[model samples]
Target: MTIKIITPEYVVFEGQVDSILLPGKQGEFQIFKNHAAIVSALVNGQVKIYTDSVPEKYSKYFTKENEAKSAYSFAIRSGVLEFNNDKGIILAE
Candidate 1:
């Protein structure tokens, strides 16, 4: 599946990723392949993406500060999340 994180300045991160653990408005949640279409309010927190490959251009955006076994993550002040099919997009401010 694909995940794209965009801010008003630019596309923060864009690439094919294995998963996204988002900071939902109510609570945190994870999105994976074949996830049902859904939309959710996101709060200020980290967005963790798990993948073996991160495009060269976006590689700089994936931080290791919060890195896990095979995941890279970054934070957003606030945002909205949308997911469907095998794609997930985040509009972060």
Candidate 2:
């Protein structure tokens, strides 16, 4: 599924990802491809993105070592995540 993480200044991340793990207000939640439509509030924690099919050029920035084994994480204070029509959007504050 395509994922987009946006902050007030700029877009944090935008790409296709295999899975996403976030700290929700209720609890931690995982989002995968074709997930049901929903919106939830996020808490203070890390937002992990698993990129299985990222492009080579962009992968260099987000990936630490290798593409397959590497994942990207962002420290979020508070935010909202929305999933709909096979797309995931995160707006962080």
Candidate 3:
């Protein structure tokens, strides 16, 4: 699945990910490939993206969280998430 994280300034991250963990208003939730469509409000927290690799150009916007190099994280103040048809987008503050 593909995911994009965008803010007012610029696009934070955009890439294919195996799964995503987001901080929802009620609690944290995880989304995997082929999951049902969803739209939710996000709170200030971290967003974790799991992928096989990260392109060098976009690596700067993400923090390496594990030795395997398959997981990365980005921080957001707040955001809205929309996911459908194996794609997800986050519009952040």
Candidate 4:
């Protein structure tokens, strides 16, 4: 499924992903392909995206030594994730 992660500043990520593990307010939730439509709040934790399409040049974009790790996680504080039909959208604050 395609997943889009966005922040107020800019779009963080947009691409195909195998699955997503999100930090839900009640508890952790996992989203797969063709998930039912819904919307929920996010908590302070890691958002894990499982994918295999890593770009080589991305390693040079970050000041940290592990810029490649950005392909999987975004430590979100408070936000919302919406899923509908075949699309998944995450809006982080």
Candidate number of the best TM-score: 3
Cα-based TM-score, every candidate = 0.90, 0.82, 0.93, 0.80
> Highest lDDT: which candidate?
3
Off by more than 4 A, model 3: none
Q: Candidates' lDDT values, in order? A: 0.84, 0.81, 0.90, 0.76
How do the residues 51-70 of candidate 1 rate in per-residue lDDT, one tens digit apiece? 87677787777785444667
Decide which is better by TM-score, 1 or 2. 1
lDDT of 3 by residue, 1-93 (tens): 999989999888888999999999899999999999999999999998999877887888889887556888889889999999999999998
Residue 5 of model 1 has an lDDT of 91
How good is model 4 by TM-score?
0.80
Stretches > 4 Å off in candidate 4: 55-71
Give candidate 2 regions above 4 Å deviation.
Answer: 53-68
Per-residue C-alpha lDDT of model 4 across residues 1-93, encoded as one tens digit per residue:
888888898777787888888999899999988888889999998887777753443322213224444346667888999999778999997
- Tens-place lDDT per residue, model 2, 1-93, is 899988898777888888898999888999988889999999998888887545554454343424447567678899999899989889997
Ranking by TM-score: 3, 1, 2, 4
Candidate with more favorable, higher lDDT: 3 or 4:
3
